[model samples]
Target: MRIALAQINPVVGDLLGNADRIHAALAATEVNGKVSADLLVTPELSLWGYPPRDLLFSAAHLEQQQQALDQLQQRLHAEQLDVALLVGVAEVAPDQQHPRLFNALALVQARGWQVVARKQLLPSYDVFDETRYFRASSSPSTLSLRVNNRDWQLGLSICEDLWVDEELHGQRLVGPDPIASLIPERLDALINCSASPFSRRKGTLRHELAARAAERLQCPVVYVNQVGGNDELIFDGASFVIAPGDDTPLLQLPEFAVSTEVWTAASSTDRLEQPSRAHQQANTPDDDLEALFRGLVTGVKDYATKCGFKAALLGLSGGIDSALVAVIAAAALGPDHVQSLLMPSPWSSSGSIADALALATRLGIASQIVPIQTLMEGFEATLTPALNAEPSGITAENLQSRIRGTLLMAMANQQGQLLLSTGNKSELAVGYCTLYGDMNGGLAVIGDLYKSTVFALCHWLDSPDAGACRAELGLGGSGPLIGQAILEKPPSAELRPDQKDSDSLPDYERLDPLLMDLIEQRMSGEQLIGAGHDPDDVKRIERLFRRAEFKRRQAPPLLKVSKQAFGSGWRLPIAAI
Candidate 1:
């Protein structure tokens, strides 16, 4: 049996468009003048896209979903294509109770499409809210197809169904063991369609989980993942096929890119006994820095294009955060369409201005020098008399940031471009960012990246290994897109004279590990202190992180790259102490 893995990026809530993309991928079945595969497999929720969220509640969304299936069926019949398709969809059952939908996989053969497998595991924790919308299935599903005058029993599972092994995850997700239940079925192959989001080292975990499943079932397991950025979540689709007793994958697909490739099952020994021929076609794994870089670029590209924006603009203050964001935007939206405004305040250094221009030139992006000195003087004059004194301290510092934010917003609105926020996770976690000031934008490109990670990514982009990525993204002929001067300098906001970030917060070197302990590890302040973190810094950071809830609530949607980003998964009450 030959199967095609259609690794695609689908826009959320675009059912008609998503269906059309699937139809197109299926139509391109010829490779070197030969039909590629007899069957096609799409990612989880490939029809309506992943995490439609509350849009699932809309009647029109449900209506369009059925319409999309009808259109896909017509296209398959009209073209007289003989390929069988396994597509993920939201299956609605009218006889069910409150939540009537099931995260389902439909088998589309010559007859038509029908629900073949309903997802039994609906994960509710950490960025998943499927329990609020989907009801779980009671039994695992198996599909039998006749190929080469022999019946092939195949077990079908959704994303979380294969993830139920407590040994790999430390604990179960309060659901029945879906993978183990399939053990009695004695299947030839297992297929899992996933829309799993990317986190640090998650690809390794996915590989391990699939390997374990293959070992238990004693069959080849194929994992298909959705690729693209959907709002806060970025899916790094590293689709592959693993067989029992094999150290490497039998077949491997590309990562962080869209693909449609075929793999043929061997007839002699069920394709499990032979060593993988895919080793000759396998690609090397990306290092952590490269993964982070691709995630940022993919996040910006999808957020802007899906939201109907062709151009992007950001406030470039010659700081590392803004500089890194500018580079990412240039790579994402193209340097020609990416615009940067050097909104230098009175306190901004001349060297900073020079560094910003040099970066713009190196990236081949258009830049404008927008001085805010006059705006500062005008605002001070307009408000000082009302208070009977000039605004000073934090208020004065925030005013400078607001002036630049306003200018950037105006440009974004006037030119109809998406504004990318440049604040990093360190600033956002500690409330070092102003509410409407540095936090204003349509999307936070690197909001999940800490200051330390930001520097590391920039350094990697400048290395020789990143040359192919730079060229692929159309970046300038560059040793480094981010200038060296911007790197070696002390990190500063430049809102006030010689104002370093350390003045407001601890050095990121000492701060990021403590933050990881608190945020991802969910450690308490006392626990962090006991683990050798600075007691004073931990106490202050906890207070700051708690107090900034309201600000984060009002800020733009941030792209998620970390295990626990400040997105939909991180919920906290603002009224609490």
Candidate 2:
């Protein structure tokens, strides 16, 4: 059997557009003509979107979905396409006696459509509220189709259905051995339509799980996923097919883009197109740079596109964070649309101005040199005498940042561009950044990325593979725009003279791993200390992390690239300590 995985990104409510995308996918593969497959699989909720959330309650949305499905069925019949389309949607059980809707898959056959049962498990933990909207089904859904003169029996499952064994938030959430029920009756394949979110090292984990399932089921498994960004979520579309008997994937599709690949048992010749390896390599300079750059570009484009903004503006401080944000802005919005404001202060050095101009010139974006020294003087005049004998420390330094922040916001307001915040995860975690100062922006690009990761990404962008075309056309030069100096220079805030980030915070070499353990792995301070991390360092970092919650609460909505991000997923009290 040759099946096509239609990896698609659909807007949350546009049923027509979603159906159109599904039609386009069907036409591309000509599911009935060249390749005779029993089924064509699409991502979960391909019609109404993965998690329609509160929108599911509206009668209008549900009516539109039914109408769209009717139209889809009519179109399929009109085209005389004999292939069975297994698609995910918000299914309303005829019995409407059921209180909630079901996260469902409906198999549209040549004759008519039938409900292939709703999800047995409705996930309700962190970032998911499936239980709030969807009601669980009692039995497995089995469907039969005739393909290539043979009857093909198949089973359907949605995103969270396959992971029955996994405990979510310390609670076991699903039935035991959901896949085992299908074993009693012979089945050709298991098609899972998913809308899984992206996270570092998640792909490897998914692959392992899929392989294990395939081995247990003794049938080929087709995994189709949604792509593109929806609100704070980004769906990485590295869909693949696993052969039952073999460990290697039979077919693989690329990530963060729309792609299609066919998988067949009899066909000995098949090629694999994998997702970008930039995220997989943590230590490699080139790959890390490409990953971070791509992540930022996606972040900028999606945040602007989804939020209805066209242009981006940022403060260029001649530092790596600002430089990286500038490059990402250029890539996302065209150079004509990306505006850089050089907010040099009285404390700012000449070398900073020189480097900022050099970068702006290389990138060919509009640049404005705004001297914030006057603004700093005005702030000092206002605050000096009010302070009796308090030492001038972080408060004084923050005044400079606030001045620059005001100037950047002024530019963004004048030019109608969204200001991109340049503070990274490391600084944000420890409250190293100033609220309403460096923290002011519409979207926080690379806010989820660590400081050390930012350096690695800069180095990668300077390498050869950085030659990949800018996501937007007619913006960047053919090759990389990052300079060797930007990649090699020591990272600093430049808020104070001769201040390096290392002066206060732990070295990134030590910092990022500890953060990964603490945040991503959810390890306690004692656990980190037990795992060879210094106890004092862990204690300090933990303290900083706990204290910074209030600042993060005020921070703009951040683009999430990790499993546990400071954004919506990692919700905690401001004073947890």
Candidate 3:
């Protein structure tokens, strides 16, 4: 049997539109008036998109989901397509209860569609509230298909259902082992439909898990993942098919793009001993930098388009963080659609101004100078009487930042563009940013990236390895998109004279590791000190992180590229001790 893995991008809450995308993918599988694949599988929750969130509670929205299924089925029948399509949908439960839906897959064929499987694992951890919406199924689901006078048994599972390997994940979800349950049935293949979000090196873990499952089930495993940015989550569609006993994938799709490819079951038997083209590509040393860059680009592109913003705006301070964000915006929205405001203050250096302009020119993005020195003086003069003294030191620095932020917002509002905040994760973690100043924007472009990561990604963009990716992103003539001047220079906000980031926070090289341990690993100050981090530094950084909670709560939504981000996944309270 030939099964087609349709890696698609679905818009959250766009039920009918998502259905059309699925149909378009199905249509692509047709050849000479005949469907090329016996069955096609899409990502989980493809109809209404993943994590529809509160939209799932709307009765009309649920009703529209049924209408969408009917429309898709009608389209298939009208096209006279003989292939069976498996799509994800929210199945209404028979008994009325608190959680009224089952995350399910429906088999749509010539006759119609039916719920073939229900997800058994409802993940309720970070970034997921599935338990609040869905009830777990009791057992595994398998479907029997007869093609060419032969019967094939296929095991069906959803995203979290296949993530039950305690050894691989280091921790297991409290639920039935879907892979183990299928072992007794002796399935032909196991299909996992997922909408898994991308994080650094997450694709590698996914490949390992699938390989493990294929080995245990003793069958080929086809994994289909959702692609595109849905809000803060970026899904890298690194879908693949793995044969039993082989860790290498028989077929692997590209990352961060929509793809559909048919894998013949018979071919896997013949090529078990030989490494496939995908395996060869996979073996070629993985570039985490390239993946990271692509993931961020995908996030920005989809966020802007999905949120109905045609252009992007940002304040370019000739600093690394803003420069990186400018590059991302130019790549995501075309250079013509991306604009920048060079908000130079009295403290802004000439070389920094020159660097920002040169970088903007190289990127082909429009840049306008919006000097804030006069505005800074005006604010100080006006607030002197109210304060009984002129705003000085930190207050003065923040006033400058706020002035630039206000100008960016004004331009964005006038142009109907998205204002991309340029704060890095290190700054956000250490409370180095002002609440409504540098933090004001509709979307935080690199808020999840550490300062060190920002520098590294910039260096990678200038490297030879990024040639293909640069071309793909339409970044032209980039010897060094972000020049050495901006890169080698010390990190600064330019809010005060010769003010360096190190003045307020630890060097990113030292601080980033500490922040990673505290935020991503959930380590306490004592744990950090025990891990050999400086005791005083740990306490100070921890205090700053906790104090910054209120700021993060009010900051714009940041794209999540890490296992833990300051977005929906990080649920720390602002009032916490």
Candidate 4:
């Protein structure tokens, strides 16, 4: 059977727009007034986009989805297309229950569309609240298709349905195994439509899951994923098809982009052979750094574009974090559209200022120097009367950061640009960053990346391995984009004289691992100590992390790139110990 995987990017709540995208995909995959493939599949909830959240609660939104599906059917019939299209939709439950919706797939032909498959495993973990929005299906869904004078039994599964291996995930969802259910059906091929978000090395896990399912069913497995950024979630559509018994994929789609390609499976009577090593090498998974860079670029670009902003503004402090954000902004929105303000305070080193300017020059992005020394004196003068003393120590230091943040926001507002926050995960985790100061922006570009990860990504960006990626991202020049000076310089806020991050917090080399354990692994102080972390250091870091909940709660939404990020996934009580 010939199947076309439509790896598409859908805008949330833009029902007609998404349908138009599907229509365009159909047109692109056609040959002389007929679709070349026997079936076309789109990602989960392709009609409404993924994680519509509260948008699902609106009756008008659901009605609009039905209208969009009707329009797509009409277009297909009007165009005389002869292919069965599998598009994701939210099926209204007939029983009119509390949730009243099922995350489902609709089989669209020229005449009309019908809901064929409903998702069974509704994930409620980490950034996903599927249980709150959708009711699970009790049984597996299967479809019998007649193509090319032959019968094919196709198994249908949604995003989380294929993730049933306990060994791979360390734990399994408590429900019927979708893969095991299909084993009794003797399926010809399995298709998983998903809107899985991007996380480091998640593509590997996806491949393993698909490969295992294919092996168990003794058939080929096709995985199609949604691509683009929706709010804090960024979906990396690394869609692929894996033949049974082979861990390597026979066909692989590009990551972090929209693509549609047709894959032809061998007849049921014949065995599906694995692809040659040369082909396998060509379709190998991307380097983690490359995926990380592309994911951030996609997040920034989509967030700005979807939110109706053409330009971006950020405070470029010569520090590595800000420097990386500047580069990402330039790549996402063209360098011409990304502007930066070098808000140098009295404590800002001349070398740092020069380095910031040089890096901006290399990137071809516009930069402006906004000195804040005069503003600092004005603030002290204004507040001294009420306090009977000048703001000193941490208060004075935070004043500098706030001053810079205010300038960036003003410029962004005046120019109608999106403001990008440059704080990294480590600073945000330990409350090393100032709330309403460095945390001020429409989106936090690197808030999910640890300090160590930020440094590593920068180093990779400078290396030759990133050449192809840089070219694809339209980053100019072959020379190092981030200078050695910025990479080698110690991390500092520059709010105080010679302010080093290490002065208040442990070294990032030690702190990031502990933070990862505490946050992502959810390790307690005792567990951390048992794992060989210093008891005193663990206690101090844990206290800091817990105390920073209030600040994180007030911070702007950050792009999610890790398994756990501070955005929607990290749920903790602010009043707790």
Candidate 5:
């Protein structure tokens, strides 16, 4: 059987657009003679896009989806494409008693399209809320196709269906073993369609799961995933195939980009003797940071592009957070399309402005210096009558950020550019960010990156290995693109005189580790203190973290690069103690 994996990027709620994307890919491969395969597979919910969330509940959305599938089948038939393509869909179960929709896979051939598979193992934990939208399938879905006068049976699973290794997890997740059930029936290949979100080092987990399923079934596993950003969730389309008992992947697709590749396999009687080379091999540990950077860039680009913004602008403070955002934006939207505003207040150091300019120059991006001092004085003067006193202390400090935020917003609105927010995890975790001030952006580019990881990524960008990535992204400068000044300087809001972040929060070196334990590991305050974290600081940070829930709820959607980001997955009650 010859199979093609379409690792695609689909925007949520864009059913017609997603169908068009699938058609375009199929046509491109046909024209280039690269998709002359028996079967084609796309990611989960490729028609309506993944993480449709509440959009699935809308009868109108479901109606659009059905129309899209009809249109897709008509196009495929009209074009006379002979390839059998398995595209994901959202199907309304005929039985009205069940959940309205079943996350399904439809097999589209030249004649028509049919729902061949429905997803089981609906994961409600973490970022996934499929239970609210999709009904879990009670039985396995298998498809038999006759090619070259031989019958081939393919086991079909979607996303969480193949992730049923309870033994590895130390406990069961209260689900039937989808993979094990397929083993008894005997299959040619197991194809899994996934819209799996990206997290740091998540590729390993995927590889293990696929490999394990292949081992259990003694069949080749084809895993195709959605690639791109949908809100805060980033789908790292590191799609691959694993032969039975193979420790390493047979064919690994590229990460952070759309990829389509064809793999030809014999029937079960004649299995592949050796593993096939990956279409795009995984450069594992070495390229982890590169992958993360690429993921963020893709997220920003997709978010901006899909949201209908061609250009992006951000408030480029001389701080590391904004600098990183600028770099990411420049890479994502291109230097010509990305703009920056150095909104320096009177308290802002001269070097801060200079550093922002240097970064802009290094990135070859357009920027303007918009001083907030005048605006600050005017705001204070205007608000004095309403306040009954001068806007002083933290109020005065946050005013500067608001002024800059407002200026950036004005620039974005007038110029029609998406504004990028530049706050890090450390600041967001402890409520150090000013709401409606520096937190104003169409998308929070680095909201998931801890302060330390931001520094490390920047350092990695300056390293020799980053040349290819920098060049690929159209970044210039033979020397450090981020520069030593911006990197070596202590992080600060620069809203007030000598306003170092250290004054309010612990140094990133200490803060990030404690944060990882508390947020990602979900350690209790006592557990955190027991793990050698400072007790008072732990208590203080805990209080701050809890208090900041309201702010986070109001903040712009942030890019999720970590395991436990403050976006969709972090569902802490704001009114809780």
Candidate 6:
């Protein structure tokens, strides 16, 4: 039997649009007249979209979804298509209070939807709070049918249902295997509908888990995932099929696009194809650098599109931070809408301006050279008396950065473009970045990536056919968009004349790991020092990280690409030390 799997991305609460898109994919399959196909399946919550969030309580959202389902039933009957449809949507039960809704999947035949499988497992762990809305199904559901005049049995499962082997108990962890129960079922295949979120290296874990289950059940498994950028989450849509024997991968689909493939029971015996290597498709394996790039692109595109802004503005220091942000902005909103500003002070190096201009030329982005010497002088004259007793310390240095930042924000205000901040994770972690200066912006492009990772991504973008657009500035060659000097030169804040970043902080190789431990892992100083770091170095790094909390707190929301990031996930006291 030929089964058509529709891989699609749907917007939350847009029931009509989501249903229309589903019908369109179904129509494409119908044009072929079902042929030998007997079933068509779509991703989880494809009807109302995934994580309807609080919209589940809205009277309009629930009403529209139910109405859409009814309309779809009429269409199915009117078309007289014999194909059976399996889909996911939100359903409200008879309970009058305290969330009577459920995350459910429905099987619709020519007559009507005969079976409804409510989600048996509600996820309530890091980044998931399904327990706040859904209730677990008390029993299992099976779909029994006949295709090609033959009988077939299939078991139903949702996203969190397969991952219930682990649990939480206050501050401790618990274990109970959920997939184990489903493994003993006597069935021909198990079909899973999911709205899984994208993370680094998630595809591998997903494949391994499904393959193990298929082997245990001795049946082929079809896994479908939702794709698209929904607010803070991005679903890497790479749905595939895995057979039990030899665990051959029958098929693999594309990412960030909607496509359908036929999964034949006969082809399941014909030849199972080998799994493709990482980087074979547009986005997989979630390479740290590649994932960082995609996250930045998505953040920029969404921030711009949602806020109704068409252009972005940023001050371009000859340093790596601004250069990286510029390239990301160009890739996101296109070169035509991104602008680079070079606001050099008296201390600014000629090489810095040249490098900034060169990069702007390479990316075909417009640039304006605004000199800030007079502005800096005015601020110094006004604040010198108050600063003379303390001498030139952090305050004086911060004034210079604030001047440049003010200039960039002014440009953005005048042109109605969103300002992009260029501070990176390393500088932001050590309190080295100037608050209200370089930290002012709507969204952070690479806030989740460390400095070393940033350098790696810059080099990666220069490679051939890595999806980077050609340089239109006539600088020659389509090599990576960032200037070569930016990658090789030592990182610097450039607050004063020739100030290198390493002069104060440890080398990024040492700094990033410490920052990762402190910020991402939330490891204490004693624990980190026990891990072979120098005591003095650990104390200094800890001090920097703790002091910088105030800066990060006021900074723009970071785009999360790691298991742990600075904002909402990592909660700690700034004065804990």
Q: Which candidate is the best by lDDT?
A: 4
Clash pairs, candidate 5, are: none
* Top-down lDDT ranking: 4, 3, 5, 1, 2, 6
lDDT tens string, model 1, 443-525? Answer: 99888988899898888888887887788778844587776898888999998998899998989999999988988899998
Candidate 6: C-alpha RMSD to true structure equals: 4.4
Q: Which digits, one per residue and each the tens of the lDDT, describe model 6 over residues 35-90?
A: 33477778888887776778877888878977777777778788877777788877
Whole-model alpha-carbon lDDT for candidate 1: 0.85
Return whichever of 2 and 6 wins on lDDT: 2
For model 6, give the 10-residue run with minimal summed lDDT.
165-174
Instruction: Point out the worst 10-residue segment of candidate 2 by lDDT.
Output: 275-284
Q: Is candidate 1 or candidate 3 better by lDDT?
A: 3
lDDT of each: 0.85, 0.75, 0.88, 0.90, 0.86, 0.73
Candidate 5 wrong stretches, greater than 4 Å: 31-35, 167-172, 272-286, 385-388
For model 1, the run of ten residues with the poorest summed lDDT: 275-284
Backbone clashes in model 3, listed as residue pairs: none
Candidate 2 residues 126-224, lDDT tens each? 678787787887777677766666666676777876765453223447564557776665566777789988766667667766766676676666789
Query: How many backbone overlaps does candidate 5 show?
Result: 0
Per-residue lDDT for 38-144 in model 5, tens only?
A: 78889999988888888888888888888888888887678676678898988887888657788899998878888999987888887888888888889999999
